[model samples]
Target: MLAPFLIMLREGLEAALIVGIIASYLRQTGRQAWLPAIWVGVFLAIALSLFAGAGLQMASAQFPQKAQELFEAVIALVAVAVLVGMVFWMRRAARSIRAELHASVDAALHGGAATWGLIGMVFLAVAREGLESVFFLLAIFQQSQDGAAPIGAALGVLVAIGAGWGIYAGALRLDLKRFFRWTGIFILFVAAGLFASAIKALHEAGLWNALLDPVYDLSGVLPESSPLGTVLGGLLGYRDAPSLGEFLGWAGFLAVTLPLFLRPSAPMTQAVGQK
Candidate 1:
């Protein structure tokens, strides 16, 4: 439950931030006429995401046990790929996102593109984020054994929406750089866990075998059935006696990914006297 909550919260907040930035830019530049198109895009993206999640869920339900495991493995892998891509994409785009949006808007309006184009731009932007969230949520839901996960996810998203609104309305001030920095680090750990979970899924599917036996059994000391253990397992990919494959997958993923993500990008240098 906590895992789903945190993942959705982070992802939802990102989508909210993007929407807020675009909306605020339009208002500041007297392009408020296009605001309706933005909302239309957002709604459409959400609908598409819901449809995708439902479709995947229905399809998975028809599979046999091994097939279901395979499907889960595939989904988890997809989610990890999307999450990694998002982290890098946002990092690279952080400095130029505002300028890019402004340029795209100007081009659309000047090119005599219909409002549909404006709507499409917003739709695609938000939909990318929405679809990614859908995939992550689906992956998490597949692993969840309890009923609390869905409720927690819903609450997280609701909170994120409120936060987004507050930021956009000037009622809240978010340190976005700091927020992403901490969340990005935390997400690396989450991704590592997901990777390990994916390996477990593949093994269940009979696709891979643990080359090494369980490293050690800690379930007696830290039972996953316990609330604290469950939280740790969900959030940090904790396992009592993890197989060699799980350990290697988790460690390798974090070791390779975290360093690159942590490296600072070149500073944005604005022209002097420009606001």
Candidate 2:
């Protein structure tokens, strides 16, 4: 539940931030006529996400047990890839995103493209984020059994929307740089868990089973189904009794990914999204 919530919060906030930036730019440039098109793009992106999520969920249901496990493993891997890519892309783009968006909008409107071009630009921006959210949500949803997970995710999105609006209205201030950095770090850890979980799924599907032995057993002391266990499991990818392969995969992923993510980059000379 917590995992899905944070995932949606971060991803949804990113989409909201992009939408807000575009909308504000349009208003400032006296291009308010294109605002309706922006909304249209947002709606389409959301519709696409919903349809894709539903289609994938329904299609996966028909598979046999081993096939289902394999499918799950594949989905988790894809989600991780998308998540990691978005984090890096955003990190690199944060400083120039606004100017790049403004330039894109100008080109779209002036290149004999008009409203459709602007609409397409907005669509791509929001849709990319929307689809990423969809992938992560689907992967996490499959691993969850309780209803709270969905509720948490929905709430997270709602809050993200509110936060975006507040930022746009100048009623709130957020340190998005630090926010994104910390969240990126946290999410990489979560992705590490997913990496390990993917390996477990592959084993279940009879694809890989080298380190089948359990590293440790803690179920008697702290079952994965317990209240604390559930929260930890949702947030940190906790497993009461994990296999050796799972541990190594989890550790190896973090070992390689976290440092690269945390390494300092050249500081932005200009604040792109400042109020």
Most accurate candidate by TM-score: 2
Query: Quick one: best lDDT, which candidate?
Result: 2
lDDT of 2 by residue, 1-275 (tens): 78778888899899988888888888888988889988998999999989988999999999999999999999889888987888888788887888998898889889786888988888988899888887888778776665698998998899999999987777989899898898888788778777888899999999997997999999999988898888877767788999999988888888988888888888668667967
lDDT of 1 by residue, 1-275 (tens): 87777778878888888788878988998989889988998999999999998999999999999999999999989989988888878778877787888788777667667588778888998899889988888887786665788988898899999999998999999887787777777777777888888999999999998655887789899987788877887778788788988999999999999989998788778778966
Alpha carbon lDDT at 155, candidate 1? 87
Measured against the true structure, the TM-scores of the candidates, in listed sequence, are: 0.94, 0.95
Q: Model 1: how far is 123 from its true place, Å?
A: 0.5
Give each model's whole-structure lDDT: 0.85, 0.86
Instruction: List the candidate 2 regions with Cα displacement exceeding 4 Å.
Output: 267-275
